[model samples]
Target: MAGFLTTHVLDTARGCPAQGLTIALYRIEGGERRHLRTLVTNDDGRTDEQILPASEFRIGDYELVFQAGDYLRATGQAGDAPLFIDEVPIRFGMNEATHYHVPLLLSPYGYSTYRGS
Candidate 1:
């Protein structure tokens, strides 16, 4: 099998999937970040397609930036100014050609991520 990257966001505070959330993927090389693509969460809080398909997948460092602040504000979870949790960036590396799942469990003030199948 070939490797690819996928992700999803769940609104832990609301006890449901985080719809309409924005996600940006970046590839890091030579100590610099290069913008790859931007994706939006569907009704199920998942991208319609893999963020990084095998055709473009590589073994290196990468980052997935979730626009949590915007989603929080839209869902009325953000309070006042200076939100506690804004953009959530998860950095990791792909060392093998296999499936990679990075999921976010998010709330208004905190978030967590893990590798899934």
Candidate 2:
């Protein structure tokens, strides 16, 4: 089977899905990062489709940039200028042909991610 990548973001501070948040995917090679695609979170805090589908999947390093600054400010979670914890970037390697789910558990001050089924 071919491999693919997916992601989601949750607002830990408010205990709800982070809807309307922006996410960007990039492929890292050598020392450069190539932009792949940008997606916005749905009402369920997930992209409607795979961020990187099987047709474009490859074995390499990739990064997911979550634009948390704007979302935090819009949601009233950011206190002031230069708020702590703005963009969240998760980097990982894909070494096999299968499904990969990377989820972000985010808060106004922190975040976490892990491989999910």
lDDT of 2 by residue, 58-95 (tens): 99999999999989998999998898988999999999
If scored against the real structure, what TM-score would every candidate get? 0.98, 0.98
What is the number of backbone collisions in each predicted candidate, taken in the order shown? 0, 0
True lDDT of residue 77, candidate 1: 95
- How high is the lDDT of residue 32 in model 2? 95
The residue-by-residue lDDT of candidate 1 on 1-117, one tens digit each, is 788999989999999999999999999999999999999999999999999999999989999999999999999999989999999999999989999999999998789999998
Q: List candidate 2 stretches off by more than 4 Å.
A: none
Error of 1 at 73 (Å): 0.4
